[model samples]
Target: MLADLRLITVQEYHRMAEAGILDADERVELIDGYILKMAAKGTAHASAVTRTEQLLRQLLGNRALLRFQDPIRLNNYSEPEPDIAVVQIDPLDYADHHPTASEVYLVIEVADSSFQKGCGLKAKAYARSHIADYWVLDVAERKLHVFRSPSQDGYQTETVLREDATISPLQFPNAIAIIRDLLPKLRAE
Candidate 1:
C-alpha cells in the first residue's frame, strides 16, 4: 500500500506557529510544502550574515528596508527565511503580512553547507516566483553567486564574484558593495 503525504499552505504554517504547534525556537522553513529544518549557524556563517547585513544597511540607507533572517512569503507553499532581504519601503509597515515576491527587491542567503540547496531548490523556487535578484554567499569557498533574470526553469544569469570583486544591486545601481566586505575574515590560528 502507498502512503499519502499532506502538503501545508502558508496560511496553515502561520496557524501552526500561532497555535504553538511549532515553537519559536525551531529553525525551520516551508519549502515546496515541506517544513525543512535549517542548519545550525557556525561562527563563519554567523559572521558573514552580520557583515552582509551591515554592508547592505550602509549602502541602502533609508532607500530600502533590510530584513535579516526573516521569512518572506514566496508563494502559497513556501516561506523560506533568507539571511537578508531588501524590500520596498512601506508606510503601513507590512503590519498585516510578510512581503511577497513583488515587494522584494533582492534576496541574499549566506551559505556554508547549504550552498547546494541555495543554488538548486531555493533558486528554482525564487525563480518560479519571479524574484528579480537572488544571491548566495558561499562561506566555505569565499565567493558570491549572483542570480538574475528569473524564469520558470530558473535564473538565466549566474555570476560568481571572487573576494576582490564588487557588485551593485539592480534596484540601486549607484550603491556598490565589495564582495570581500560581505565575507567574514578568518583569523589565523
Candidate 2:
C-alpha cells in the first residue's frame, strides 16, 4: 500500500459508478483497493485475445465457461476484468453475481502496452487470491508468461515461453494451446 494514496473498496467502486463518478465505458478496475485505469487495447492485443478465446472455446466446449473481458471478483478490494477468465460452468451463467476467485480456473491477459502490469501487480493479485493458473500473452514481445503455484506472497513458479511453445491450463490439462496461435502477426508498438 502506498502511504500517500487512499484506497477504496470494491463496494465503493460500484457506488462510484452508480453515482456517475465513473462512467460505464471507463476502462478502470479495482486492484488492491486502488482504482487504476486499464490500458487501451491495441490491434495486436485484441486479435490475440480473440484468437485465444476461440481456441479455448474449441477445447473447453460445454466443460467450462469462457468470459471475455469480464469482471471476476478476486477479493474485497480487487475485482478486475481480465481479458479471458476460464471458470466453472454455472447453471445460471453467473447472472446472480460476478464470478469469484475460487470459481476461476484460469485467468489470461493479452497485453501490448500493459504487459508489465499484467505480469506484475495483476499477477500478484491473482496469486494472492489463489488463482492457480495465470497467463499473460505478451503481444508486443510474442511471448507467453505463465504463472503457477500461487501463494500469499506471489506465484511460486513463473515461466516465459516462446511463440513456438505449447501450454495447457491447470484445469484443462489435455487442452493444449499453441503460443503462435495466441499471437498472430504480432509486432512491437
Assess each prediction's global lDDT (C-alpha) against the native.
Answer: 0.92, 0.92
TM-score of each: 0.94, 0.95
lDDT of 2 by residue, 1-189 (tens): 468887899999999999999998999999999898999988888889888888998988989999999899999999999999999989899999899999999999998899889988999999999999999998888899999999999999999999999999988899998899888563552
Q: Per-prediction count of colliding residue pairs?
A: 0, 0
Candidate 1 lDDT (Cα, whole model)? 0.92
Candidate 1 clash pair list:
none
Q: Which stretches of model 2 miss by more than 4 angstroms?
A: 1-4, 186-189
Against the true structure, candidate 2 reaches a TM-score of 0.95
Candidate 1 residue spans exceeding 4 A from truth: 1-4
Model 1 agreement with the true structure over 1-189: per-residue lDDT tens digits = 224888889999989999999998999999878898898899999999999888898988999999888899999999989989999998887887899999999999999988898999999999999999999999999999999999999999999999899999999999899989999986761
